[model samples]
Target chain A: MRTTPAKCSKPNFKIHHRPIISAAIAKEQQIVGENEIQKSGFNFKKYMTEKANSVNKALDEAISIRDPPTIHEAMRYSLLAGGKRVRPILCIAACELVGGNESIAMPAACAVEMIHTMSLIHDDLPCMDNDDFRRGKPTNHKVYGEDVAVLAGDSLLAFAFEYISGFTVGTSPARVLAAIGELAKSIGTEGLVAGQVVDMVSTGVKDIGLDRLEFIHIHKTAALLEASVVLGAILGGGNETQVEKLRKFARCIGLLFQVVDDILDVTKSSEELGKTAGKDLAVDKMTYPKLLGLEKSRQFAEELLAEAKQQLEEFQSLMAVAPLVALAEYIAHRQN
Target chain B: MRTTPAKCSKPNFKIHHRPIISAAIAKEQQIVGENEIQKSGFNFKKYMTEKANSVNKALDEAISIRDPPTIHEAMRYSLLAGGKRVRPILCIAACELVGGNESIAMPAACAVEMIHTMSLIHDDLPCMDNDDFRRGKPTNHKVYGEDVAVLAGDSLLAFAFEYISGFTVGTSPARVLAAIGELAKSIGTEGLVAGQVVDMVSTGVKDIGLDRLEFIHIHKTAALLEASVVLGAILGGGNETQVEKLRKFARCIGLLFQVVDDILDVTKSSEELGKTAGKDLAVDKMTYPKLLGLEKSRQFAEELLAEAKQQLEEFQSLMAVAPLVALAEYIAHRQN
Candidate 1:
């Protein structure tokens, strides 16, 4: 018999992520016709560490190879840090999910990460967030100083597109072009910039309401998240139906991710959080938990999960689908 | 007729941009061919207004239409200001030159301009050049504040690729991808970032030689200039030889343009130069005139022009090549 909704759902349950695959992975192949509903969920922590190390190596090599060490070094400083490689990993995972290969996704994945890295570098700049720390270490600006940090971010953003453009990804030009377009939209004025603009302006304002908050989080964080999954699906050569479903799942997960981040800002210990805890509270920044009480915020997160799962309902018991499904749930439930 | 290094080539009688195409609106065939070249010269003053207006208009509309206005507005401020659309204009001209087409070149052109615009916006920030004025007006950060300026620059950079990726250019995906890669590499850490780093590090240093000055100018200004022309050629379907030759010409002219700027800093009136004059000197920034005597710098500029024209010699009589032929000379000889 199916477990009760109460039994299946946990508002505060913590998992060591030891089980490896979500429970839905078992049912995937039998239920879904061809989808890999039991795919391994990306280990965000592990993936980040691995990718960060690779990036560091790449940064070091890049520095030695380039004429001007300082500029490349600055770019490398941020690119190598141990931030979540969620964006690039999504690109790879999605490409595989759609039955596409990994080679094509590699460049796109790198590009997305570069763009993401650039954003973080700039965001932590003195004139913006004035952040002294990120990923439990000194921020890019803090380590490299302001000028190099600024230039590094710019370089990374530029390199992102360049990397993707050079990749031997798809056999079709249309698909490649589409991928570039997807990336551009994800990082450009419509996505990151718009979100950043509002966030910067809205700082210290306590009453920013849910709609505005949604707008900020959606563009700032969710756009790239959606793009990441969509890129994966597109890379996988999935049809429009699958793409649509994945996009919706990604969207739900993106929102869930942000809400959880907000909740963690208040609930997580400083050590667990990596960076400063309660910094949001100290700054008076508007956040989900701030506007909606902790329990209600948790409820909103649960709602997002339900919506996300519904998007994948058509795929049923496919093991490949499990990764995304697990990821969405994890976004809501993870402590940090 | 063969005006070689023979008889003091085109002496103080250097050509001026006399747009020979009185029939820009004539038959499509005429407008499509060598005739278009007549209208394609570096009319920095004229192109600046139109290109600046259309691009800024699109930028303004894009930002103003966002859900929250502040962020977009901040981005819009610096972008809308008038500056020589040298890089973008070159892209279009090069595209038109090779393919007799502008359609495929427009997106690349726009992307190049967007990237260039972003650089300027950030260059004006407190952490970088910290200039109060740009193109005779308040720098982006000065007018919009540092935070907004940073976001605006970031927004534009991301949007640059998006514009190219989403274009209806009907060019080969390979060429488009290649151009994007070039753009990314040129602007990213390997090129621009490296240049900016050196520029910042060398500030207040006395008696930096010509080599260091060349390093800064090449990466800071010439990399993108070279990319602009190369991107145009690649997208416009020029043969490899043509593409390479144009890159050489662009590099020469790019450096010459900066050399002229440095000279202007020493010589031109503030009103004539538009922006604050002699700022480079104030910061002990190295410039051509500082390393090489003024007369020697002027001679060097002239010599660079000769080299640039020589690179274009293969296409000299093509008539379509005349604009660039004249344009390179203008870079060295311009009053401001």
Candidate 2:
């Protein structure tokens, strides 16, 4: 059984075929570290824990065991199964940064997480990635039968929209509708499904390039992330410029998340990652590390982190922007 | 290969274990027939054909072949494949019944169809009903592989919401939000999924009662049907009383649909049904025909149809209610 890593650590630089980082990127990393630490006294770990706890509580309340217990049980089993809650945290953080309270964005936050969970469940199906586990637990299909798992995922997807439209408070219907549109777009053919279809079809094919790789990751991973932040900003009453700027920021960090994930897949052990580490390599799937080399991938992640933070520089409130800055760092540096 | 019946016909009452209809129900059916036909000179077939063509055009335009052709192709294969477009036409009919034009309800009409198509794709998966054909053609999974079929279903479900929120015109955002909420609720644990889980679990269980059977069909079939009409009414600026009345009408006809379907299942051949016939009996699944005798089931259906029509009595415009009246008749009497 795979076990999760105990702590976040630097990427394994001693791995074979990985070249040393250039002086420019090393210097850029140092500047980002100093600027972010000196700008705010925010403790990201505590903030994340608090936000995740609140979101979990809300999710628990939102999807209680009603009639037809099995499907609801299956849905809750996967949904409550632990992750870092990155998407919900990003949603809340973005909302707060744009002058909106947590309550206003809570439904949207839960919505993104539900969509994320649904994708994970379906991706782990026997017909898809065929993973035996997710987030250190038996995958949904392993615990429940595939039929129930599929139904559970479908229920979660539908309920996410229900929860958002039915439970969101303190936001105008127009803004709520806009947020819903963003979310729906992120998961459909033009969004996550688009990437998934391309990725599935491209599997086992040789000579895949950076363009195809980027297209997959951008849609599969970044689309929802971008939606998360955009939804928060929109619900929080952010101005058009603020929403657009934050959108760019989210895009950078979203890609950064994938790059870091690719680096960790090859560098870490199965025990360290909770999931099957090196599975991508086993499947001959393309990744940032495979294309750019490990050191360069790390450098790309750092650059994305820097660019993500740069988008927040005009906010003028160091305190307001600190959580987002730290979130970028977290995405860049998470080990598992 | 299953082939569709060429024409609609009355139920087959000559089968073994089926009794003749009672005089009371026969008289009630005659009264309803007279009331509906005398109220308006509406041509049900032309209205259905025109409405279905319009909805098909909108749906075709809504989900064109875009990037990553496989998933789009799969979605269109199931979505645009021939069906009666009952849900979309119901939406348009309900909209018109409440003084809204077809254009005002077009997006929602397409949305309900999208959701319906998604449910069908997912339902036909190997892990679910495992059917090899649908609508006289190969199932989505049969044509596109299970993985792509799943993704296509997901894409359609998400895109349904996206289309509703992004394309709905001449309606307030609040009404659109309300419609979205209704659509979402109809498919989640409290609605369709709720029924599906119960039905899946109850398969082959001995001594299943009419109540459990009703619960299943209500959620599995009626929920979406109810949402279709309710959404149309809501988006078309219907008053609260009108919407509620239509909701009742939708509920009666929704249950009527499944009851008639159950009756037809044992009475029709695979060719006449356009899909697997007697599969429910083969699996010993709980259905209306199995619970209540076939004749009693038909009598119940007539009662439901009458109650459904009764809900539209106060609409004050016989012309406005004609399409809905015809629609309920179409659902009750459809051969496949």
Every model's Cα RMSD, please? 8.8, 7.3
Q: DockQ for candidate 2, please give it.
A: 0.76
- Backbone clashes under 3 angstroms, per model: 23, 0
Q: How far off is each candidate at the interface, as Cα RMSD in Å?
A: 1.4, 0.6
lDDT of 2 by residue, B208-283 (tens): 7766776788789988999999999999999998998888888878888998889989999999988998999999
Please tell me the TM-score of chain A for candidate 1. Answer: 0.82
Candidate 2 residue pairs that clash: none
lDDT of 2 by residue, A1-336 (tens): 111111111223111222333447545644335366555677778888999999999999988887778888999999999898999989998999999999999999999999999999999999999999898999999999999999999999999999999999998999999999999999988778888888988788786776677778888998999999999999999999999888888887878889899999999999989999999999999888887788878777876776677677678777788788888888888888
Cα lDDT tens digits for candidate 1, B1-336: 111111112222122221111122222212222334446543544644665565555445544545556656666666667665667767766776676466677777777777888898888778889888878888878877887777778778878787787774767777887888888888876567767878898999886655567668878888899899899889988888888878887877887788889898999888898888988888888887777768767766766666566666566445556556556655767787
After superposing candidate 2 on the true structure, give the runs of residues whose Cα lies further than 4 Å from its correct spot.
A1-39, B1-39
Cα displacement (Å) at residue B115, model 1: 1.4
CAPRI level of candidate 1: medium
Per-residue CA lDDT of candidate 1, range A1-336, in tens? 111111112222111111122334423422322223334344445644664555445434433436677666667666766565677666666676677765666666777777888888888887888888888888988877787788888778777777667764564766777777887887766688778877877889868776667767878888898888887777668889888878877776777788889999998887898888899889888888888788767776776676667677776435555555555655767778
